[model samples]
Target chain A: MQKIFSYSNTMILLLLVLCAAVFYLTGEMSSGAELFPRITAFGLAFFGIVELILSLSRKDSMEKPIKKENNQHLVRKSVLYMLVFFLLVIFFFLCFPLIGFEVSAIGFMLIAMVLLGGRKTLRLWPVAILIPLLLVLVFRGGLDVRLPTLFF
Target chain B: MELFGAVLNLLKPLTFLAMSVGVGWGIICGALPGLGATIGIALLIPFTFGMSPLVALPMLAGVYAGAIYGGGITAVLLGVPGTSADAATVYDGYPLAQKGLANKGLTTSVSASAFGGMFSALILLFLAPPLAKASLAFGPPEYFLVAIFGLTIIAALSTSSIIKGIMAGFLGLLLGTIGIDPIVGDMRFTFGAVYLYDGFPLVPLILGLFAFPRCMVLIEDLVRKGSSQISLNLDDGGGPKLTWRETWQMKRTYFRSAFLGTLIGILPGAGANIACFVGYASAKRASKKPELFGTGIPEGVAASEAANNGTCNGSLVPLLTLSIPGSPTAAVILGALMIHGLVPGADLFTKHAEVTYTFIVSAFFCNIIMLVMGWYGSKWFGKIVQVPTYILAPAMLLVSLVGAFTVRQYTFDIGVTIGIGTAAYFLSRAGFPMASILLGAILGPMAEAGFRRAMLIGQNDLTIFLTRPLSLALVILTLASVFAGWRMQKKSKPMKDALSGKKETQ
Candidate 1:
C-alpha cells in the first residue's frame, strides 16, 4: 500500500490527471488552437508514466525505515516552518496594495526576520525598517518609478 | 567603422557609469553565497526598465561578466564556491589560500577570467553577424524545429533524469498556453482575468523562478541551521605575488580552456558551470603534474576561472542570432531584449545594428571592468559572504516581489509571481530542472506560432517540419543533440558521484 502511494507514484498520478484536465478543458477550442496543448499534454503524460515505472522498479524508492523514522520529526518541523513562511508571504501579498509597498514590505520583513529566529537580536529591526525606506526612496526618487504609496 | 562607433557609444559617461556599477553589484552578488549571476540579473531587470537599451544591455553584460569572475574570489579565500561556475575553482583555490599564496590565486583567477572573457567576446563579435545572416533563411518549419531542438537539448542535459526534465518543460508549455490561443485567439485558461490577456509577464516570471526559490532555500536554511552569520578572517599580505612571467607561461592553458569554454557555451543547455569543470579536467590532462591539480596550483585556478568567464560572451552568440538562449543567464537577457522591443535575428544586425553591435562591443569593456574590480575589490567582495541569511532572505523576498510589481505595475503580477514561485519551489523539490521549464515557457509561443504557420503553409501536412532542407537539417541536429546530451549525462554521473563523495569525506 505504501509503495503504491509513494512520492513518485503520486507525482505520476497527479501529472496524468493534469494532462487529462488540460485535454478536457481545451476540448472546446478550435482544432488549430488545441493542437499544441494537446501534444504537450500527451508528451507530459507519456513521460510521467515512464518515470513512474522506473521509480517502481528502482530499489531506492524510499529511504531506509530507520532513517525515515529518525528524521520524521525534523521533516515535520521544516514543513511547519515552510508553511509559516508561505502564509506570511500570502499575508504580505494581500496587504501590499492596501497598506502600500513600504508599510507592507517593512512589516513583512520584520515578521519574517523575527520568525526566522532574529527575535533575540536588535540587528534585524534597523534592516527591516531601513531597507524598505531606502528601496522606496531609490525606486521613487532616483529612478522615478512609482511604488504603491498611501499618499499617492 | 560601425564597430568603432559602437566603442565610442559605450564610452559615453552614462553608459560607462552604468556598466561599472553593474560590475560592482554583480561582484557583491556573486561573492555572496546563494545569490549568483541569474538572480543578480533578474533583480536588476526592474531597474533597467527605465534606461535606454544601449545603457541597459551593456550594464547587464557587465553584471554577467563580473559575476562569473567574482565567484572565484570566495572560492579562493573561503573554500566555498559563490556560484556553481566556481565549483572547480575551489579545488586549488582554497588550498592555495591555506598555503598563504592567496594573492597569487586571486591574481591568477582575475587575469585568466579577463583573458577568457575577452577571447570569447571577440568570438561573439566576429561570429554572431554571419550566424544572424544565416538565420535570416530560417522559415516557419525551421523555427518550429529549432524551438523543439532547444527544448530537447535542455531537457536532456539539464538534469540527471531526462524524463523529469521533459515533463517540467511540458508543464511550462502548458502554463504558457493559459492566457490566450495565439493563432485562433481563443482564450484557453485565463479564467476571465483581464490581466491574463497577454499571459504571464516575462520579467516577473523570470524573477519568481530564479530568485524567489533561492530566497526560500535561504530562509529554510536559516530555520534548519540556526541564524548565525558566517565569519571570515583573511591575511591579505602573506601571499606570493603572481608575476607577469608566471602568467605568460600559462598562455597555452588559457587559450585551450577559453576555446573549449566558448565552444561549450555556443551549445544550448551547457553553460559556465559545465565549462569550468571541462576546462579544469582538460588542463589536468595536458599537465605533466596532473596529480597536483587539487593541491594548490595557479594553473588550476586560472583554468577554471578562465573557462567560466569565457562562457560569459560565448553564451550570447546563439541568443543574439538564433533566438535560442545558450544558458539560463542568456535566457534572462533574452527577456531583457524582448522588453526593449528588439528581436534576436538578422533583424538585430540590420535593423538594430547600433544597439546590437554596441552591446557586443561592450562585452570587451565589461571584461576589463571585471578585471579591475575583481583585482582591487576581492577583499571587500569576500566580506559580503558574511551577511546573515535572516536579513538576506527577507530583503531578497521583498525586492523580488517589488520587482515583479514594477514590471506591469499590477498588484496581480506580484500575486502571479508568488504563485509561480511557490509552484517552482515544489517542482524543483520533485527533481525537475527549473531551467528546462523556463526555456519551455520562453520557447512555447515560438513553437506554437511556427507550427501553426507551417501547418497553414503546408495545408495541414505535419511533414512540413521535415520537407524543407533547413528544417530537415534542424530535425537531424535536434536528434543528434539529444542523443549526445544523454550520453554525456551518463558519462558524467560517476564523476559527479566521485566529486560529491570527496566532498563528503572531506
Candidate 2:
C-alpha cells in the first residue's frame, strides 16, 4: 500500500509538471501568459522534489514485508461496489433528462440500494417510491428549482 | 458605546427572531447524525432569499455559530459526535457521562462553547476592521505569499508521511488550474467539455471529497463489523449541573483553547476539526491530569468545546475581511450570500457596515442560544442515536445528491461529485490528507493568480514576490514553517522506527 502510494504521488506530480510545461509553451511565450504557468510549474516541481526526497529517506523504514491474514476480507467487494456505483451514476446522468428526474432518481436509488442490500422487499418498495417523490417535491415545489420533468 | 449601539441594532425584533429561528434549526440539524452545519446552512439559505441580505446574513451566521456547539450534545451522551468538529468532545465527554456525571459534562461543554464563541466574535468585531484596512494594501504578490503560507501549514499538520500531504496539496492546485483562465479568457484543460468551463463546482466537489468518502468509510466499517448493534442511553438529569464555581476553575483552559481555535480559524483553509484536534492535544499537554483526558475529565470537554466553538466564529474573520472562506461551512455561507446577491469584499464593510456589525452581534447571540439550547435540549437530542444507519445513510445520500444538483442543474455535477468522492476514498485509504488537498484546491487559484500578476508587474522577475515587505515576510514565514516541519519529521523518525521494531519483535 505504501509503495503504491509513493508511486502514485510521483506519477501525479510528473503529470502535473508535464501539463504545466504544455501550458508554459502555449502561453504568450513572454511575460504575458507564459509567466504564470512557469511559476506554477516550478512550485509543483519543487514540491515534487521535496516529496521524492522524503519518500526515498523513508523507503527503508516503510518497506515491511506484507502479512496476509485471510484474503477473504470485503476489500474486493468494496472495490466492486464502488465500480458498480460509478457506472450506475454515469448511466443515471445520461438517462435522467430523457426519462425525467423523478423516474431516474427513484430507479437509480432503488437499484443501487437493493444491490447494496435492501433485500427486505416490503421496505424497499416504499423507499423506492417515497424517496424520489419527496426529493422532487421539495426541490421543485419548495425551492422553485426546476428538474428535468417528464410531466408538464 | 459604538459597540453597544451596534449590539442594540442587532437586538432589533426581526433580527432577534431570525437569530433564534436560525440557531434553533441549526441545533436540531447538528444533533442529528450525518447532518451537519454545512447541510443545515445550505438548506436554510434559499429560505433567506426573501429577506434583505443584512437579515439573511446574520441569520446564517447565527446558524453557523449554533451548529458547531450543538454537536457536543451527542458527543457527550451518545459517544457519537454528529460532526467532525465534535469528535474531540467525545474524548472526555463520553467518559464523564459513563461515570454518571453526564449533567456536568453537558454543562462544561455548553459553557465552554459559549465562552469560546463569544471570545472569537469579540475578536472578529474588533480585529476585522484593521485587517480589512490592511488588506486594502495587498496586491497579487502578497496574496501569492499568503497562499503559500496557508499551504505550508498543511505540511506541519500532515501525519506521519509529509510526502503524501504535499502530494495532495499539489494535486489540489493542479485541480484548481483546470478550466478557463481567469485573466486571459483562454480555456486551459476543459477539452471542449462545457461542464469543465465553470471549473469543478465547489459545493459538489467539496461535499464529495469530504462527506461522501467519510460515509463510504463508515459503510466499509459496518460491513466489516457485521451489523454491529449500538446501544445508547441519554445522560441522567439527576445531578446538580456544573456551577459558575467549576466554570471559573477552568477559565484558563477555556481561554487558551478559545484563543488557539480562533487563531486557527482565522487562517485561510484551517477548519473547525483541525482547531478542535489541536486544542485537545494542547490541553492534554498543558494539563496536570493528562492521563485522565479520554476518561471524562472536565478539562478535556472544556478544551474541545471551546476550540470548536471558537473556530466557528473565527472563520468569519477572513470571510468579512478578505472575502475568503476559512472553512467549508464558511464556504457554504459564502454561497448563501452569493445566492442573495451579496458579494463580499472591501466595500461591504463600508456599504453594509450595519449588516456586517449586526451579523457579528448575532454571532454573539448565537453562542448564547447554543448554550441555552444545549442545556434544555440535550435529553431530547440524545434520542437521535436510537436511529439506525440503514435508514440514515440513504436519506443523507439523497440530501447529498440534491445539494450537488442544486449547484448547477446538470447531471454532470453529480458525476463529478461521485468521481471526486471515490478518488478521495482511495487517497485516504492510501494515507493522504484530504483536508490539505481540499485546502489546496480552495486556495490554489488565489496563489496562482497572485504569482502570475506579480511576475508580470515585475517584468518576469521572480524577485518581486520576495522584494516587497509584506510579501517577503510571508515568504520567509512559509519557508520557516516548512523547515520546522521537516525538522519535526526527522526528530520523530527514530521513535517511529523503534515502535515498528518493537511490533515486529512482538
Specify the highest-TM-score model's number: 1
lDDT of 1 by residue, A23-139 (tens): 998888775778898999999999898887777777865312123655576667777988899999999999988988888988899998888777655787789889999889868
> Clashing pairs in model 1?
none
- Give one digit per residue, the lDDT tens place, for model 2 in B116-157: 999999999888877777777889998877666656666455
Interface RMSD of 1: 1.5
State each model's C-alpha RMSD to the native: 2.6, 5.3
Most DockQ-accurate candidate: 1
Q: Candidate 2 at B204: error in angstroms?
A: 2.8
Q: What TM-score would each prediction reach against the true structure?
A: 0.95, 0.81
Write the residue-wise lDDT of candidate 2 on A1-152 in tens digits: 55434544545455456656666555644424444455555666776677556555664645332334364567667657656766776777777778888888777778777766667888877887888888777678756667788887
Interface RMSD of each: 1.5, 3.5
- For residue B42, model 1's alpha carbon misses the true position, in angstroms, by 1.6
